[model samples]
Target: MATGGEAVARLDDGRVIFVQGALADEAVVVEITEAKKRFARGVAVAITERSAHR
Candidate 1:
């Protein structure tokens, strides 16, 4: 998760992934639906770790 409350992650290939409905500092599983040259967009499919803020 990001500082702004959005989930920002990096793939193994170094691609940037963004997810909504996620808490900052939380660990989650995401499913990518769209892929671009620089980044990919997805939603939080599962939350592995709950954040204190959530």
Candidate 2:
């Protein structure tokens, strides 16, 4: 798990992770998929914990 601030992740992974309200900067368990673009978009299937930003 990794924590970052203002992570601008490319939405290529075709997984619908956490929506709004989920914490930011905390690593979350996600199911990711490859999007049309050359990046990975993911959805947080499970939130490991609250992010520091929360």
Candidate 3:
């Protein structure tokens, strides 16, 4: 998780993506909303696997 509360994750290509409304250890399918050189911003389009802690 980030300081801003967005769940931080990495893509298959290793780019960092900040996902909205995601919990720690959750498997989410993200829809990329913004792209940048070092990171990306996205929303969880679908929760592929919900977090057990949630």
Residue-pair clashes per candidate: 0, 10, 0
Candidate 3 per-residue C-alpha lDDT over 1-54 given as tens digits, one digit per residue, 9 for 90 to 100: 998889999988889999998999999989999999889999998998999887
Better of 2 and 3 by lDDT: 3
Scanning candidate 2 in windows of ten residues, the lowest lDDT window is: 1-10
lDDT digits (tens) for residues 1-54 of candidate 1: 566556888888899988877777888888888999999988898999999978
- TM-scores for the candidates: 0.81, 0.42, 0.89
Q: What lDDT would each prediction earn against the true structure?
A: 0.83, 0.47, 0.93
Which segments of candidate 2 are over 4 A away from where they belong? 1-22, 35-37, 52-54
TM-score of 3: 0.89
Compute the lDDT for candidate 3.
0.93
lDDT of 2 by residue, 1-54 (tens): 224322333333443333332455655665654444344445556777766655
Better of 1 and 3 by TM-score: 3
User: Pick by lDDT: which candidate is best?
Assistant: 3
Model 1 clashing-pair count: 0
Q: How much is 1 displaced in model 2, in angstroms?
A: 16
